[model samples]
Target: MTTLKSGDKAPDFEGVNQDGKKVGLQDFSGKKLILYFYPKDNTPGCTAESCNLNDNYNAWLEKGYEVLGVSPDSVESHRKFKEKFNLEFDLLADTEKEILQAYGAWGEKNMYGKKYMGVLRTTFVIDENGVIEDVFKKVKTKDHTNQILKSLNI
Candidate 1:
């Protein structure tokens, strides 16, 4: 439930990636960034979404975009997830949920009639200048690359 929309300045964020490397919005300066937030590491929806993106990573690069996945999972968890999926993009370990909260990606979620706080799956398409170009709140997990490409009309 992010309030940020297309044309807004993307929130500044710094996170540790799967390789224990610091990654931030500034690192993507002069490049379009696909910043995605998900709930967990090995879940079905997350896997589908991530795999779809990974499967088409080359196309995204050819079109001038870098992808970054973020989750509340630990660095170790992210590492395993990436390795298992052969993901080419970096996955950020937001254990503290700091970046998630900053982007409004962490909030109340209801499941099975119970409410709990969790990651709100969302993606922000940021431009080279750090401005958000698009926001996907209802991502079609199994075909995310096409979903994003279609929305951006690329």
Candidate 2:
């Protein structure tokens, strides 16, 4: 399937969160949602990016946005990552790669001169109406949160 683009209707999916709670896109209806897709949990870059979002969570909340992290990790892994870093938002377990594919975050990746299928690390800012407002592709872990913040002007 072709990946969704800005102004497209965000795909709705049901998944278990870090806390093992069932969540769906409809749960976030009427609220601005920041849906960030990362390659892995607990990895250096992923950790840094997630922590950065956690650090500025209050500011994001102040702007009336709900944050949700999605990864191809199992619920168990997500639980550990969330607890280890004290992540304040839900990290949806996309173990099936269904959501990643829908968002175009799953694709070829290179590491150590080896090519493999992996997530491309992206973020989508969806408005209250569930239409994607912004897309951040090939996110830089270090400055990712700041980029989103700047884009939202929050």
Candidate 3:
């Protein structure tokens, strides 16, 4: 449902992390970023996706990539989730969803035969130059790190 595509310039984003520290696209100018947007903090899918990323956190860093997750949850919620999952990366609290909308990660969604507005499970592989290298709209939560690695052939 997003208009963003590979090779396109990544839309700028800024939000507070679980620690209430400001984070933005400009912060990772010389490294790749795995910017993922999820629906909630403790849901099954979201948790699996987050844990998978955290499990391979060092791999991403070794390769000069940073992982950042965004959700409409509050900083308190994010902090708890991170502590529960032992996640080392930052989880941005995008309560306003401005970053979500800019990256087209928020839109119409369907569940249990009902439709509503929600966050779309999406990941943007942004290159060092702030260009989108790839976009994963069909993320495999349980094995997302491998999914991305296989997709990008990295």
Per-prediction TM-score: 0.98, 0.94, 0.97
Stretches > 4 Å off in candidate 1: none
RMSD of 1: 0.9
Per residue, candidate 2 scores C-alpha lDDT tens digits across 45-137 of 999999988888888898898999999999999999999998999999999998889888898889899999888888999999999999998
RMSD of candidates 1 onward, in order: 0.9, 1.4, 0.9
Error of 2 at 138 (Å): 2.5
Model 2: lDDT to the true structure: 0.89
Instruction: Write model 3 residue lDDT over 1-154, tens digit each, in one string.
Output: 4589999999988899999999999999989999999999999999999999999999999988999999999999999999999999999999998999999999998989999999989999999999999999999999999999998898
Clashing pairs in 2: none
lDDT of 1 at 136: 92
Candidate 2 deviant stretches above 4 angstroms:
none
Cα lDDT of model 1 by residue, 34-146, tens digit: 99999999999999999999999999999999999999999999999999999999999998999999898999999999999999999999999999999998989999999
Candidate 1 vs. true structure, TM-score: 0.98
